[model samples]
Target: MAQNKQKRGPMQFLQFGVIGFANAAIDIGTLNLLLLLFHTDAKGLLLLYNTIAYTLAVANSYYWNVIITFKRSAEGSNRQRILFIVQGLVSLGVNNLIFLGVNELLQLIGINNWLQYNVAKGMAMFLSFLASFFMVKYVVFRDYGKRYIDEKN
Candidate 1:
């Protein structure tokens, strides 16, 4: 079982990466579209667009991750769903905060707005990917019984 679990971990990670890439593309693409459509130079509007896009991406991620990446770990319990949502919200907050901070810093350093936005989004996505993997693996979908039991006990 331990070996099987170990094998599954890498497969899960790959699936998670694929799903995350799709979701992040959706989010960044939506934000860019909104920016292009608005023709506005307001930071607040960008933030607002990001918030909306992130929410949509989170929802998409939850479904895909549950069905694809963590299918074996998924429980058909309301508690599991709630836990997943909480984990996602935490990731969302971390990603958004990092994005805003990095973007602002780049702006202050006189980086071009286009490059700043792309770089900030890329960094935030990478960080959030790491954060979400750990949270989902150790918190939301943890196998408590397996962890507490020992082979020689």
Candidate 2:
């Protein structure tokens, strides 16, 4: 008989990647649509546009990760959702920092202006994805030996 085993380590990362691919598509699609609509360069308003796109994709990622990646949910789904959103906001900050850093590096080399926002965003998302996976695993969805830990006596 074969025992049922759950994903761990690299497998976890792989699962995250699958969901991340979907998220990336949503993010890039929204970004490009916004750019086409407003004609804004992916420069000064890049972070703003990217954050908007990321926010939408994040909702998709949260549910998928909970159902597929983590294979668990918090006692109260609402609490879990709020926590997930908090984690996402933090990851967004990390992503923006990385994206800006990558952009600066490309700038130092010149011709970076020719590069699209997706270039730096791709790298940033990878880093943020790693961070997010860990955050969701160890923090957001940890089984703390309680269903709903009551805060009031």
Candidate 3:
């Protein structure tokens, strides 16, 4: 798959990072909204809220990453979509694990609060952002020649 990484410029990575900031806002905002509304720090509830927020941000990520970041001309074939979703699930796993793990550590350190929660969430987002970028670039939007269903076709 390394060969599929064409001579793309670092500018694309910068774009991905910019888009990632938007995604992070969506993710953190949604999670905070849920936490504020529910007023609970329970483990299961936090996981559920985090999942909802992460999923929403991922949907936005898929759209912008395809149209702007990668700048693909494909008509978004089912295969490509499936690949994107698969990578998303994997990234979600990465995110959730980091979140829960960090949250647990903060709890052990007796620092449970809004700031602590966000500290965990931020770490999760940053790591998973890197994972998602590479997966989308090398796997989902890799050069597949005529396999892509171009709109002009």
Candidate 4:
């Protein structure tokens, strides 16, 4: 069992990476689509669009990470679901802060365009991705005694 866990560690990370890529695509794609459709580059709208995009990606992440990456049995208990949501919201806050910060810095430097927005988004996605992976693995889906949650002895 220990040997299996040792081997599965790296494999699980790889699977998580694959899922992360898909999540990134969904996130960035949705944000860009919103930008294009609305034809507005307003800062406030960017936040709104980013939130929508991130939320969609997070939903996808929860689905795939449970089934393929973390390999949890099913949808899991209410506590697990609540933890996921809390983690996701924290990650989203991290993502948005980085995104807005980077974009603002770029604008201050006179670099304003799609490239700037994407650059900020990319940085946000990467940092939040790392945070999300750790939280999901160690906190959300971690095994506890006979189940994913601890029971009273």
TM-score (all chains, Cα) for each model: 0.88, 0.79, 0.87, 0.90
Return whichever of 2 and 4 wins on lDDT: 4
State the C-alpha lDDT per candidate: 0.82, 0.76, 0.86, 0.88
lDDT accuracy of residue 15 in candidate 2? 85
What is the Cα-based lDDT of residue 10 in candidate 3? Answer: 73
Candidate topping lDDT = 4
lDDT of 2 by residue, 1-153 (tens): 012223355676798899999998988788778867776645668778778888888888986877787774345477777888899999998888887788778777775343646677788888888888888877888766542442221
Q: Candidate 2 clashing pairs?
A: none
Locate the minimum summed-lDDT window of 10 residues in model 4: 144-153
Across 55-97, the per-residue lDDT of candidate 1 in tens digits comes to 8888898889888887766775787788888988888888888
Determine which window of 10 residues in candidate 2 has minimal summed lDDT. 1-10
In candidate 2, stretches whose alpha carbon ends up further than 4 angstroms from where it belongs are 1-7, 74-76, 112-116, 146-153
Q: Give model 4's TM-score versus the native structure.
A: 0.90
lDDT of 1 at 19: 95
Per-residue lDDT over 60-137 for candidate 3, one digit per residue giving the tens place of the 0 to 100 score: 988887888777533588998999999999999999999999998998899967987899999999999999888887
> Which has the better lDDT: candidate 1, or candidate 2?
1
The best candidate in terms of TM-score: 4
Q: Please give the clash total of every predicted structure, in order.
A: 0, 0, 0, 0
After superposing candidate 4, which stretches have Cα over 4 Å from the reference?
A: 73-75, 146-153
